[model samples]
Each structure stands twice: as structure tokens, then as C-alpha cells.
Target: MSVRPVVRQLFRIEQLVDMLLALTGKEISRLQQILRSGTVVYHYYRYWWEGFEAVTEDLQVLLAKFPDADPSQAFRAEQCTAAAIEQAETQAPAKKMEVEIPREAASRKRLLRARSLWECLMQLAHENIPAYKTYSYGRHADIYVWEILPDVRGRLEKAVERFAPRELRAPLRRILQSSGALRLRFFVPR
Candidate 1:
């Protein structure tokens, strides 16, 4: 089934925040080195490492508006809680989750301090959490949507719906031609 646009947009933000939280672990230095070394096979995917860091910096700016005492701790707590819930359910042999009980050992694996952010991300991804997602931009290599948290999707939709038809075709054309996307083209998630 297709995901609703609102859910997709919200999940995108949640995903980016999760990644940033993973990046803040105690062994960040080691994780950073592992990330910089190209975690993927192809040399081109190495761009992802730099892209992840750059996106983290940008996401931090976006997060600054909604300050929290310790988002990383909160994120870890949420993960642990979610794992516990799943593990609890797995104890019921009649439940469908019995097929997957073996992997739920993660619920009991509590660490006082995360030893590697990269490893944490890998675990999250293995659990089907949206740690990161990338797609080709088509026109230009690839574009990232590193979770511009808040109701950016809604706000942008309203802005476009409000501005698109009423505004002239000439001015937008001139801006697109001269400035080259100084003003972003309207984005409507399908």
C-alpha cells in the first residue's frame, strides 16, 4: 500500500532526527572515521558519507528552533521502549511474532554508552527503521530530503497553493532563468 503524503513527510523528519541522534553517540570519533571511509562498496556512494554529515549540520540548524535538553537520550529511550514492547509480544507463542523472536535479543542488549554510531544506525536499518534513504534527483545526480522537521510539507503546500496560480508566469520565469532555482519550484509529494 502507498503511504499518505503527510505520513511520508512526517516520517522523513523523524528519520533525519533519528540519524542525527545516532551521530551523537559517545564513540562518535570512531564512527566518523568509519563513515568517512566509505561504508558502501562503490566509490560514488562515498558521497553519502559527506552528504550525511552535511545534512546533519543542516538538520541541527532546523532543530535549534525546537530546543530539547537531550534529544539523543530521548531517541535511545524510545528505541529501547519499542524494542521492549516487541520482545514482550514475542513471548506469546500463539502470536504471529513468534516467527521473529530470535532477533529480538536486542531488547536485552542495553549499553551504558554507544560504542559506535555506525553500528547503531545499521541496527536501526536492519529493524526497518528509516535511518536514511536516497534517490536519484534525475535532473541533477541526487537530492536529499533530510527531514526538514515541523510542518514544512504542509507549510510549503499552502505556500504553493496560495502563490502558484495568482502569481505571474513572467517573474517566475525570469527568476528561474537568471537565479537558477534561487526560489525552489513548488514541491508536491505524490
Candidate 2:
């Protein structure tokens, strides 16, 4: 094979990578928009999960192409942009989960999925992109307070103890404290 063909192929691959990066950035922006929109709808839970899957797929393609292309800056920029949009669009009152989140077992399942997706996104951002400082403090703690805490109110300590991974205790306690909905001692060690 002539050097000319090899060079042409390399240029084509580079162009393809650039296109993929741009498309992925757009996907990330849309995902952020979905997050910033408002209360997590049951239907939207699947959407959010799918969005993360798309972003992961894009990241894989990017890594395959460059192996060193840090798209972290792109992700960070989108997060900021989404936050600004969210702030501007915040004129409407937050819709309470009472109506949106049902107490049924199926709804509870979806709610857990939503919480998992939130954690997954946070982990991705923390590891790959810049951290959102509020995430650790209780970015979406209301879900837990409104959904899980209510079911286990009488047995708060026991419920919290039963919760696995053990990392969720302290922040959850802080959220509960700040919320003023319930007063319970968090027995889990910090």
C-alpha cells in the first residue's frame, strides 16, 4: 500500500473521531437538560438511564480513537450550561414528589432506579469530569427523604443500618437534619 492511501485513511479516521466527539457532546448536553428540568418523572427514569448509556457509548468510542482525549472539559462545560438554564427556568415552583412518586411497590422500584442513576452520574462526573460540589451535600437528597425515609420512619436507625454500601449514611443524615422532617440519630459511623 502506498503512503498516500495510508495518510488518507488516517485523515478520514480523525474526521470521524471529531464528528463522534461533537455528537457525544450534544448527547451529554441533552442528558444534563433532562436532569435540570425538574422532578424525576417515572417515565423519565428510563430516559435518564438510556442517556447515561449513550454517553458511556460515546466515551468508549472516544477512548478507542484517541485513548488520551479527555472529554472532561466538554462534560464540565455542559453541566455549567445546564445549570444556568435550570436557574433561568426556575421560576416555576418545584413539583412535590407526593403526586409524582407513588407509594406503590412498582413506583418504589422506579424511584430506586432513579436514585441509582443519579449516583451513577455523580460517580461518572467525579471520576471523569469536574465535581459538582453540591452533589456530596445532597444534590438530590429530597428523593431519599421523601421516598425511603417515610417508609422507614419509625425504624429510621434500623432502616439506615440495613442500607448497604454504608457510604450513604452520613449525607443522608445531614439531609434529614436539614430537612426538619424528622429527628433521628444517625447511628452509622462517619
Candidate 3:
């Protein structure tokens, strides 16, 4: 009941809160990747759907559980992020969807996309976090990315310098900033 003990308890609680925030951020991030990939309702639709629902519900429950916390702003920010992605995908013209590229070219384009996707995700995690405030611990940076950030970043850097043809390298590095979009339109099968 003394001042020292009260401060000690408060410090300990903050540490616990930070860890919880990191874990929650990481979990929601994983869900976002699944949702972004359009795989939630794929072959394993039921399983992913159940898990996604649970994670989304956990967000609502977290709000209720934290009495002093007002995460309305964060929730609204998240909604805006989702809306932005929706708008970007829907606004593109159907005619633009058709394009012709070889398999070798497609692979390069995908690698470009992989790097772009990684960068976009990291930026979002760093700046435009969708979770509750004070929880942007960024502990989920390397969580599920098949290739690590540094490796992808390094490759992207090298790709910029290594490719001899401007036509080949220009589009990849011209990175169009988006939430989780890989705008590889009209990649025709060879």
C-alpha cells in the first residue's frame, strides 16, 4: 500500500501490457496477411474463417476488457485502411487487367511484388499501425514473412543495380505504395 509498492506494481503492469500488445499486434497481422491474400475462403476456408472470426472478435473483446482504454480512434483508422484497399482494387479498370508477359518475366515481377509487399507491410507496422495505440511495439516484423526483411531489402537493392535493362528493372523499383496490393496486372502465361 506504500508509494514504492504502488509504483512497482504499475511498472510491472505496463510491461505485461506491452507484451500483450505485441502478441495481439502479431496475431492481427497474421490475419491481415491471410485476408489480403484472398485465401481465407479458399480450400481451407472453414478453418481460416473460424480463426479470422475469432481474431476479429478478440479485437472487440479487447476494447471491452480495457475499461480505461478508448480505442475508437484506432478502430476508425483500421476501417479507413480497409476501405483504402477496397477502393484501390475496385477502382482499377477491367481493361487494364489484360497484359502479356513471359514466365521468366512473371517470376521477376513476383519477386518485385514480394519485396514491395514486404516494404509496405513494414511501413504500415511502423507508421500506420491499425491496432490500439501504445501497442505499436513492432514485435511482429519478422513473424511470418517467408523471407526475412533484410534479405528481401538487400535483394531489392541489388535488383536495382544489377539489371542492365531499364525496361526490366524500372517497373519493379517504381514501387506503387499500397496497403498489401501487388499490382501485377496482365501477366500472360507463356
Candidate 4:
């Protein structure tokens, strides 16, 4: 439970993004174990916060590249209609059912959007956000992530609403809002 292993695992961009985007109950429980096992270093907390900020900023840039109208809407509407038709067909006795495989951005436009988003996300590993210096130092204290990074949660919401793909909007919000990641904040004392 040393700080180095914890930092290497948690502060990594790909791992962090995956944690944010695909957090599970099991993962949260594990993260809780990590948090409760060790005293979190102050500088590491700043690094962790900056990781989240980088994820959000990179997503914003990718989303800005999307066309004004979200291409996913049309596909979503088609899917709903297809589901209704399928449900009606299912009610009829003894029909052979055809399985529908979902495509993640099958069309060229969608593929492009997806690719750009991927690129932005990959770039997060290399990007750095300059941390502002804080002169005041106090006794070690545990602080809520939202409390210390006040406006960041709000910014994350705005980015999701404005730029996130239609499918990702809900899960991203739910996971980040309720996951163990938010509980990882620390206020380091010198």
C-alpha cells in the first residue's frame, strides 16, 4: 500500500478514464480498500485531481469537433422503432427471431467522431495541466473531492451535456457522481 503503486495505478490516464467511464460495484469496493488502507499523500491528491481535469478537457476538444446535430439521434430513433416492431412481431406465435447486433458508430460520420474522441483520450496521457501553487499549509485533512475541486464537477457536467456522445451521457454522469473516485480527495499538510 505504498504511495508509488497507488499513484501508478490510479493516476494513469487510461486506467483513470476506464475507471470513470466503466466503474463497477466490485471496482468501487476495491478502490475503497485502497483508500482506507493507507494515508494518501497530499501531492498525489493534486495529481489525481489533475488527471480528472485532463480527461474532461480532452473530451471537450473532441466533442467540439462533432457536427452541430448529433448523428446518434437518428440511429437511436431507428432503434426505438425497430424495437417496437420486433416486440409486435414477438407477440405473433412461432416466428424465427433475428438477433440485432449493435454497432458502435458503424457509419463513416460516426466512425470519425468515435476516432477523434479516441485520439483525444489517448492524448491525455501526454498532456499536462499546470497546477497552481497554494501557499497555506495545515495539518493533514481529508476533504471531499467536490468541496476542494468546487467547479470541476460542474464543468464535467457541462462537458457531458454539450460534447459527450448520446450513449455515454448517462453512465458517465452516474458513475462519476456516485463512484469511489469522488471519495479520493485529500488536503495535504506540509
Please list the C-alpha lDDT of all candidates, in the order they appear. 0.29, 0.29, 0.33, 0.31
Q: Compared with the true structure, what per-residue lDDT tens digits does model 4 show for residues 55-163?
A: 3445445334322222222111212111000111234447423222122321112333434222322122123221212211121111111121335445545544554
lDDT of 1 by residue, 1-190 (tens): 7552422122354443334343443234443454455343222222233323434455446545432333122122232211101111233447412111112232223345332222332343344332212212221111111222234334433332333222222332232233111211111111
Which candidate's TM-score is highest?
Answer: 4
For every candidate structure, what is the RMSD over all alpha carbons to the true structure, in angstroms?
24.5, 20.2, 18.6, 21.5
Choose 2 or 4, whichever is better by lDDT. Answer: 4
- Model 2 lDDT on a 0 to 1 scale: 0.29
Per-candidate TM-scores read 0.18, 0.19, 0.20, 0.22
Q: What is the model-wide C-alpha lDDT for candidate 1?
A: 0.29
lDDT of 3 by residue, 67-168 (tens): 332344333221121111111243545622222223233233343344433233334334433444332342221111111234444544464445313443
Candidate 3 TM-score to native: 0.20
Name model 4 segments beyond 4 Å from true.
1-120, 128-155, 179-190
Error of 2 at 28 (Å): 20
Estimate, for each residue in 18-60, the C-alpha lDDT of model 2 and write its tens digit: 4333333334455344434422333222111222223556545
Please list all clashing residue pairs in model 4, or write none if there are none: none
Clashing pairs counted in every model: 0, 0, 1, 0
